[model samples]
Target: MFSMFRPPTLNIFSRSSRQKDSPKTDIIPHLTPNRFPKLIIASASKTKTEFSQQQKQSHLSSVKKATANNVENNKGPKADIPTSRSISTFPKKQLSSSPPIPRSTDVQPFKGLAKSPSTGTFNSVARIDNSSNTNPSVRVNFHLKYQTSYGQSIRIVGSHPDLGGWNLRHALDMHWTNNDVWTATIHLPSSNVVEYKYVLVSYDSKGALSWQSGSNAVLAVGEEDTALDVHDSWGNGPGASVSSEGGVATTREFKLQAWAQDMRSYKEVARSAAWEASRKKDELAAARAQIARLKMELGLGSKERTALEERVAALERANLLLRAELAQGKLVLKRTLEEAIKLLSQDALSVEEGE
Candidate 1:
């Protein structure tokens, strides 16, 4: 019976001796015959501790690999495992413990910029120019009074780019406000000096334009002035005195006279007709009075009565010739006015097309 119990003591002695001989193993206390159950329990605990250590080593290797991958990919820093914690307190728990807490990286990208793939350079963002939206612009208003007949319109040409650069073919048309008034508005750059002129344009004839008879109208715009108004009349300018005796002035004067003739020709014709009628009546009355007196004084002569009849016929013929001349004058005036209007119309159409 003692030999069966002796085998347990012998096994404990062998394990304790083996532990003492290994350099890495801890020295377990020698077991007595009465502590046989304790020896078996301690052996089971050592096996469990070895298994927990292996699991912990595997978890640590995996974490190290993950951290290196994050660094190479520039994914920022990773949380560190707490090696300061005592592993003996809960060796098995370490393998099943919660994951390490993540940490934020200090690396930051620039704002309002983007990287260009081809050039491998950073470019700034685009922004719109705000000065144009905030700054006020210069404006000019033109007001004119000119009488245009049928097929004729008024135009303005100038030396600046905005005003067609003195090209009559690109002249700006004026809006007719009334029978005589015309108006237009143009925008100009600030602090600019501009020269311009007005012209009468014909819609049917080429190269038939009537320019204003004076030097170009000049304007000096100030930077501080945002708006300006100019009032003018056709063929009238500040330098008109210099053109007073020139060919332009003479031609303008002739046109004015023609216009006056067109306006009063009917009245003049009617007046002439009335004057001729009155003169005829007076002549007839005087002839009758003379004939009666001659008959009474001469006591009925055939030659004197015949002479009175001849005088009456001559007076009637003279009156008829005056009426024919008056009709011809009226017809000539009508035709002349029509030609003038057609010439003005052609100039206007050419300018519009060229623009």
Candidate 2:
């Protein structure tokens, strides 16, 4: 019973006893030199592997950074390559390496001047509005100008499309003012309403013709609206109609018929006059050319006559000198011959006497 129920003993002394046993086992930590060296080598290898892994991680991080930098740099704006459309959109711009051309808005013409029936009269002043964009090259100036006195007369005439009556028309003198405004001085026989339009004579950069303004102006006079008929000299009457009632006229079938007739008459007269003038000018020029040619001929003949006279004088003087020299030579020969004859005769006499 006592053996089986052994009381728990204090093992604190048992551990000390075991440690003190065998001289504390002199348990020189069985650290054999080779084992120690092997342990140290193993530790060193593990440390080297850890260092190599760290180096690999650092190199990988550097490569990732370089890739990131390249991605950022690749995102910059690209170079602008000129396209064909860019060149063709503006040929001049392309040629000059310039920008595109700007468009211009439509411009209106200004109204100017009133007039009376008196010829070559500047009875009224023209007023032009200054509220507009002016042309760059054109400097706008206004002045009272009068048309030159014309030799022709503004006679009234009448005509008829249905039968015959007065159909009038007019022409306006339009010109550019100093301020680049177009001024029109309209002329017509005394009338009420007049309708007209403005026409622009313009050209493009390529010299292509273009019109910028309307061909006709606004409703002008009012006389002809009420006074219209096909009865007069032109209405199958005795004498031809000489006087037109209204100054301006128009028709769909006979559009500007009166104007055309007047223009034809004026043109015929102008052509005849021009022909006569040109013929006279040509005749005058011809006369002048002929006169010049005759003068040149006369001058040449005079010079030739002078040269011939000098030659004739020289020949006459040479002939006279030659005749004198010949006469003198003859006289000397005769004298020498006489002297020789005398000598011969004297010698013969002497010889005979001697014999």
Candidate 3:
């Protein structure tokens, strides 16, 4: 029973076995021992090489796509972009070696930064000429030499506006460089004449002043003379060239004026002295007449007579003193006039020679 339940097996290789058992057999070709392994290895290596080549091609394509995208997105002008040649021209060492250049706004020029030279320095120099558009007048230097006592000063007054026009209130004060020398500079018109004089002014009192006892210094300015210097001593006018005839005439006028002034002063003194003496004489005569009347009175006592006599003696002494003083004053006046005349004559002669 169990044998019948078993499954039946068909012979799939029955034909191949019958053929194998038959006397006619198929011829088979023989392969070499090493050829199979070689073939397998070659196939594997070819597959791996193909895979690597595909990966490289894909990577290059992706890079090219990315570069195209960047070029499309950038919108700036082409000229602003730095090129290879411009970059190569700037040396890397020079760029890193030094500081950057300052802009024009940060730098200043030497002309704007230069300083003026200080006074009295070697660089300070005086200009040769003072004439300019702003100042059309000429410069006149006044130099004077004078000896003064204590409490006295020298001043200059003149006919020109620069010299105060003979106005003491506007007189220019002179600067004393030494005990005897005074100097000043004035501006005058280039084509105008100037007449000036030195004066001695008392420091304490303006009223006690003495002018130069001579004619004013006459200076004629021409268009050619832009600068002039006047040198003078005290009581003398400027020592400069002048017309001979004009100088002579001016000198004579000065002498005559001085003489007349001196004569007037002397006359006043003489008149005052004479009037005083005459008054004293009248007083003395009255006293003498009273004494004589007292002596003629018979009732007058010896004591009264003695008193009258004493009074008369006193009057006589006063009269004598007055007479003596009068005589001395006359002599002094005569001598003074003679000396003044002599000095004036000498001055006149000198002025003529100077002219």
Candidate 4:
């Protein structure tokens, strides 16, 4: 009874079960009196490892704290440094009081200008001729009373060069103003009397010259006179009577010729426009014909393509039938060859049996 009640002894260094698991086991299927020592030993080893880790952590914390304390003690000293609040409480220099600048707003006189002249001096200056001239010549206006035709004009001829010096080529043509007046502006010599006459000039195909038949009119200019308006009349002349009728006929004929030319040009432009329109119509018709031909060709091409596709399909079907027939004939020939060989073997066997 004592031996049956005794528990089995355990080997602490046994490797069979421990080696399969590990040198140390964390799990077990069942706990008995024999496993109590292993559980206690595993728990003791865990406590020792935890305690050693806690001591290492505490030592590391102490070393970190000592290094932080040394770094804080090594910072610079703060002797005699002024704080922000104390610096704000100190006194500062004040700005100086200044006077405003002086400025004058009164209107001032022009320093370099001369004063106004007296009444006598003003009267003398006003009496002088104010028209500016570089030579000793007086600007003169020559007005003649005449009604000029369209192709007829009035010209002034005089002893002075400005008045054409009695030369027909250099005669100055006078412009016709209102009220049947022809006026010409000419410069004449001052302090002398000059003679000038009017002539009728006709601008025609004949190019006729007509001169005045009367004595010349005189022009007296003074040194104090800057300009003068001398009015005159057209003198008697052979060309004066025919001036109106000749100019009117010539004017009418020229207008008629110009109208005829315009009509001819309009006719030519109409013909050109008609020709261009006909050409464009021809081109349009040709283009439409070409389009119709191309459409017909395209329709024919589509028909040809469809017919070709159908013929190709038919040919392909014929080729496939030929191939199937050829394969069947080959199978039949192989069977026939096998039958002939069997028949020849049966005849030879019969001959041998008879022998």
lDDT of every model, 2 decimals: 0.56, 0.35, 0.56, 0.50
Tens-digit per-residue lDDT, 245-290, candidate 2: 3534333213233333444454455555555555655655565565
The TM-score obtained by model 2 is 0.18
| Top lDDT model | 3
Off by over 4 Å in 3: 1-135, 241-355
Candidate 3: lDDT of 149?
A: 80
RMSD of each: 33.2, 41.6, 36.9, 53.5
lDDT string, candidate 3, 321-345, tens digits: 8788788778757766765566567
> Would you estimate the TM-scores of all the predictions?
0.29, 0.18, 0.30, 0.28
Model 2 misplaced stretches (Cα beyond 4 Å):
1-66, 70-250, 253-255, 300-355
Clashes of 1: 11
Instruction: Give the Cα RMSD of candidate 3.
Output: 36.9
